[model samples]
Target: MNLNLRNAVISNVSGNTQAQLEDTIVDAIQSGEEKMLPGLGVLFEVIWQNADRKDKQEMLETLENGLKK
Candidate 1:
């Protein structure tokens, strides 16, 4: 069977309120399961695509700092 993970992930979270979305992300992170990474990546992709230049820069800075630690 063919599966589209990114679309599936987006569909799963579609129409979620801010709090619901935040909880989903937090839960995924706290779970520390590799299976959740793709979903997180998809979410990040959506954010990155919509983010302004400043937001993208901040995200990159945060990621860089995180990797340096």
Candidate 2:
């Protein structure tokens, strides 16, 4: 069985509108299921790749703050 999770996740959400994407993310997070982590990670990767330097720094800072608690 050869499965590419990243590609699969991307393809699943490829044509989603912004509102649909937001709903997917919120639903995933609220589900609190381990299986959703990889999908969230792929989404974060997409966001990180497209973010500017300041945005990346802010994201890192936010992650750092989140881990501190």
What would you estimate as the lDDT of candidate 1? 0.94
Off by over 4 Å in 1: 1-3
Candidate 1 residue-wise lDDT, 16-41, digit = tens: 99999999999999999999999999
Error of 2 at 40 (Å): 0.6
Q: Give the TM-scores of the predictions, in the order they appear.
A: 0.91, 0.88
Global lDDT of each candidate: 0.94, 0.93
Q: After superposition, how far is residue 17 of candidate 1 from its true place, in Å?
A: 0.7
Per-residue lDDT tens digits for candidate 2, residues 1-69, read 114888888899999999999999999999999999999998998899999999999999999999999
Q: Candidate 2: which stretches are off by over 4 Å? A: 1-3
Which residue window of length 10 is worst by lDDT in model 2?
Answer: 1-10
Question: Which number leads on lDDT?
Answer: 1
